[model samples]
Target: MAVSAEDFDHRCEPCLVIDQQIEAHGFCVDCQEYLCKNCFSYHQRIKATKHHHLVNKDNMAKHAVIKESDECTEKCQVHKKEVIKFFCPKHEALGCKDCIVLDHRACDIDYIPDKCTGIGDSAEFREVLRELDQKVNEVEDIIKLAACRENELDSCHDRLIKEITMFRKEINDRLDQLQKQIQTDVDRKKFTDKQAVKNVVETCTNISSDIKQRQSRLQDYKASQQNGQLYIILKQAKSKLKSEEIKEADRSLEKTNMQYTFEQNQDLEDMLSRQNAFGKLALSSSL
Candidate 1:
């Protein structure tokens, strides 16, 4: 009969140390080493390693291939010579039998491999991934909202500048109108004063001409011995010289003097000063 690959026994790893070619009959799960029948008997008989878990070679071949270092062959940190095979759920720790009996006596305990069965496909793993995705979406939403707020701030700033420019133009326009109105009033007053002064000069010239004519008439009368006409002329001249019309005209001119000035508006000044802080930004805690 031809030998089959499946029926062929693997060489024992420990037997190779003595250059012996013993066939492996089992695998030590804790020690992660192949064992022959003789070595398996010796492994079971040992006091320290007697409780170490073992699996038949046929059963071990059906499981996933495991690296020796990645296996449960790790020695317990507290119990140096013991392998860690049990997990304590209550304390959330892994340890050897001695460590579990000493520190986690009353804790819920189980084999580490048994608890790890189908963990990758478990619902809790999916739920954790879902929660992480939700957190990422929330962070993205916050970033989008912040970008919108930045745009709003920029728009508000531009609008404020536009409003300021508009108000400034309005103020300048109003000031121009007021200045024009004041100039118009000044021009009218000037024209009226000039006309009044011209009238005064015309009246004075007419009075002087009348006085000269009366003096000439008096001389003619004196030459002809007309004393009565000369006396009448002197009485008219005295009344005309005592009139108060010229004094009244000088007082009216003095009253036409106008003074223009601007008064400050404290409220408007305060409002303008506060323009330094046009807008304020605040964050919402709801995020």
Candidate 2:
């Protein structure tokens, strides 16, 4: 019966390309290919691939993935066309043939395949893989924390804006109320001052009219040549003009200096000039 490909989990990459359907026992690290028992023995025996590093199938459970195309794709940075074949342990660097000859000639370099022999099964390699996994988990946690912080920041920003807007509205409303009150006070003061001035003017006009009437009366008496009547009229006019009521009116007019003026609230002005007039924003490092 023909063997179905489903029977093997890790099929030999070299055999899979040729439709051989062979099971792989080992994975070649340098060549990036899987080999059967016979192929693995042959690979080691071959002079070209004698120093090639390989990993057992069981050891490569997490390392190897079977593919149809299998070949070393790593190329040198300096020599683009040449594949990397040597490793410098001192610098932990990889280079091609010309690169090794020119730069790493003084250093004791090793064949990449030989240097990587049984690397997958090494304690250091396993520890490094575990460390990488831990580091990745840490990065994911940090990212999650950053996302939460970003969301919190957005919320805080919105809340603060609303508070500021509401506070400003409140301040404006209070200012409006204060303005109305001050306007009412100003109007009352103006009315009171104007009424006082009008009273003074009325009093002065009445006194002047009375004096004029008295003078006209005296003129008539003089024209009649009536000495007694003229003398009596003159005496009455003099006494009335020098009365206490007239003297009080003159004193009131002199004392009354009605001038409207406004003084700003210094406390309010100082509060506005301060940096944290509305409120202060406090920040803490601890979450």
Candidate 3:
């Protein structure tokens, strides 16, 4: 079988304990040795050596340089005696002649280096790099916008707190004014009621003094045995007792107890409970 250039590119380093014809499937960094698949599997399965790190043969191509000056000696993994000679583009794989005949007979095949040549200068390659740069810029913009939004969120929070505090203070100040007005009304009513009671007491005191004076005069009149004077004094006392001022004062003092009560405004309480002053925050649909 004719060995392809891809074989040279993927050629594994020679195993220490095996013939050069056997290709390595893995490389152990600790032991610094190339291993066939069977040996690599055995090394990992062993409890004593399982912890050691290993790199796959395919991945080692980038780090390991296979010189073109050296003879092609690496064998295929499937056909152990045959070397890889062609790359299948449809399958995106490297294979020996037997592998191509068995699994990729209908697939388009090409020389690896020839297919890959001038790829760096291709428009598709440049477009890919351009898209990557654009994606990076977009990510950067997103990060910057997010950072700005974070600051805005903090600022908005502080502003809302300040507004709420000011609003609360205004409510408190209004409440204080309301309290003072209610207190003033209470004081005014108290003064008016007290003055009414004072006036009633003064009128009753005057009536009591007049009745005592009339009683004294009648006693003197009776002692002198003057029936006319006694009759006149009794008549005057009866007339004074029936006076309008005395009758009105009696009725005024009967209903003199001033009563008052305070109750909370349900509408105001409901509004406070529902709205709570500090509004709600919501995400925009655009975001």
Candidate 4:
């Protein structure tokens, strides 16, 4: 209860109204009256005025006036219109009559006004307040940790994506180099094989022309009855036919069948077949 400043001769208002002069010792804000010591004592005893704000004359000028509604009218959270009047010891909660009937029927309850006596200065109350503050701080720490972890998650995701992209780029660059090298090899092989086939064709044509010339000479010799010259030509032609150079040419033409094939890396193929993800995700609290 607080009192406000107002012009006064410091006389009891109730006494002055009855044409009696008495010094005021206190002021009742709700009644707007000044009272002597006796009247102040009676004011404290009476139930109606007991709850009213009262300030002694010694402290009246030090405080502002208290409003009528300044007294706490704490209402039930569940039943908003009903004042909280009961305390449940087991649940450590305040409730209205309806709450007691609905939820706290089996619990031993006490009238809140009676239960509140000396509670404001109790050691248990202070301890409860300390525990509440500690719990609140712990929850705040957990919230901060959650925020940090969320940011870290995003950072890790971005880093993994960049790594995967770099790995893919490296593989693509290597494959491109391999493709160019293989294509160059194929071209060089085609050139060399083409030259070998041309040489074989030229050798076969020269041999056939020599044989045809020999055959024409033999026919002329036979017509002129030159049997000795014919015999020498036949022997020379037979030796040339069985020569190692001619046999080697025949083998070279057969060996000239060129074919090429390419195979993928087995490890790379197995990785593509078996792997579904780039890497596994692991969660650790201690990091």
Model 2, TM vs. native: 0.59
Off by over 4 Å in 2: 1-71, 78-82, 97-108, 115-136, 173-185, 222-229, 244-251, 254-259, 266-271, 274-280
What TM-score does each of the candidates earn?
Answer: 0.45, 0.59, 0.52, 0.50
Each model's RMSD to truth, in Å?
12.0, 12.0, 13.9, 12.3
Give the per-residue lDDT of model 3 (tens digit) for 1-287: 97653564332332321223446777776554566787788889999879877889776544443335332355789999977656787887887767777787677775333345466889989999999999999999999999998998899889878887898798899989988999998888778888889999999898889899999999999999898999999899889878888888978876667477777778777777886444565556643
Whole-structure CA lDDT of model 4? 0.77
Q: Candidate 3, after superposition: displacement of residue 264 in Å?
A: 3.7
Q: After superposition, how far is residue 250 of candidate 4 from its true place, in Å?
A: 2.6
Give candidate 2's error at residue 233 in angstroms.
2.5
Sliding window of 10 residues with minimal summed lDDT for model 4: 63-72
The runs of at least 3 residues in candidate 3 whose Cα sits more than 4 Å from the true structure, single-residue gaps closed, are 1-133, 224-232, 273-287
Candidate-wise lDDT, in order:
0.74, 0.80, 0.73, 0.77
The Cα error of candidate 3 at residue 243, in Å, is: 2.6
Per-residue lDDT of 1-287 in model 1, one digit per residue for the tens?
Answer: 96543565676755643445677888887766678889988999999779988777787565335554344688989889978878877887988877766777777677665456576789988999999999999999999999998998799779868888887798889878977988798788778877876776776677678878877887887888877987887787678679776676666656655565556567766866895533444555532
Per-residue lDDT tens digits for candidate 2, residues 20-83, read: 6788999887776778888888899989998988788897576655442323469888989978
Clashing pairs in 1: none
Candidate scoring better on TM-score of 1 and 4? 4
Deviation of model 4 at 90, angstroms: 2.0
Candidate maximizing lDDT: 2
Q: Please count the clashing residue pairs in each candidate, in the order shown.
A: 0, 0, 0, 0
